[model samples]
Target: MNHSPDTGTFQVIHAYTRAEAIGDGVLVDVTDTAREAGYLLPVAMTSAAWAEAVAWDETNRALQDEAGRLWDVLWMARPAAARTGFGQTRIAFDVLRVPNHPAATEPHRVTLHVHIGPGDDGHAVLTVLLAHED
Candidate 1:
């Protein structure tokens, strides 16, 4: 994805109540509109910050992806009770830091930490952090 340049310094911001999912079996209903909010960060940062942000994003993606896979496995293991009715789930993410750069004078990289869990209302919630580094 590409980011526009900005003059402000970038910082990690929390993306509360981002993605969502519901349903059972292999046919899970998922939505990722929350991911779009992450791009709102600044667009330039220091080299160190940029590297850190990139690392954070990489780690975050891996963790979230793995969690999703695990969820799939769990769903498949269930017989019927867990498959019928509505199964609640959630995912959360946290942004680490923002990078700085002289060329852009803002942070362009964004890092996110994601978590998935079951919601109280028989639904799934996804938590995610959106950070931008320059």
Candidate 2:
């Protein structure tokens, strides 16, 4: 993605990479003007912090990609409900092996929440809450 050299804060993530990471099922406009696909990290996140978040033992890009694939499966399974109103679902990911932290030895549970609702136009909006566990 060619992140900015400054690894302190405000690392510039290419919009295309983010979009590809999310998947090709939906189109996201990431331009400054559109801002439809804005990347909103937790308020306290600096570039270094973001790096740590991605490099964490339990949760990382691979897990996120798995969750996205799972979401596609979930969407296909709810075709009947999707015809009328909103359909929401969630799945838990048991952080495998390697424990959750550098010291801890037990696995932790991370949940991915999916919200499928009607979009502004004729399309649909698929919102995935990547960090919601409960």
Candidate 3:
């Protein structure tokens, strides 16, 4: 089956993280922030085959594979504040997928934007953007 690039769409799954206050009582310790962040963000891909897989709840498998391969690159690319928890941290993101004339090998691209500090409830908010390419 042939899928049109313009038919693709992006979706945001959820946002989550594991964080602990630092010893200095000034920051928090977030281990494996990238992995955690990745999990929080939804998966995106440009493949009719992959999209079909996702419809059947098989997207996790694809995400696992991609994450395994790109974890290092994504993790290292994370912002400094995200690496070291200072105050309450929040990563807010919006996932978008747009069809192109010819789909690229990596159809899905995750654009992540983070926010640090406590919310009104005095809790950390991690914002994530999940985009899937059609």
The candidate that achieves the highest TM-score relative to the unseen native structure: 2
Q: How would you encode candidate 2's per-residue C-alpha lDDT over 30-123 as one tens digit per residue?
A: 2222122232211111122122222244443234432333333233323422343433333222223222245654434433333444334434
Better-scoring candidate (lDDT), 1 or 2: 2
TM, every model: 0.21, 0.27, 0.27
Q: lDDT per residue, candidate 3, 48-124, as tens digits?
A: 31232112222332233433333432353355335536553434333332222233223454444344444335554
10, model 3: CA deviation in Å? 36
Q: Which candidate leads in lDDT?
A: 3
- Candidate 1 global TM-score: 0.21
TM-score preference between candidates 1 and 3, better one: 3
Inter-residue clash pairs, candidate 3: 5-99, 8-134, 88-117, 90-125, 91-126, 91-127, 92-127, 93-129, 94-129, 95-130
lDDT of candidate 1 over 1-134, digit per residue (tens): 23335845555464222122122221122233222223221111222322333323333323423234323322322322122234432122323233323333233323332323344443543332223410
Model 3: residue 103 alpha-carbon error in angstroms: 6.5
Single out the weakest 10-residue window by summed lDDT for candidate 1.
Answer: 18-27
Total backbone collisions for each predicted model: 38, 0, 10
Task: Estimate candidate 3's alpha-carbon lDDT, on a 0 to 1 scale.
Answer: 0.35
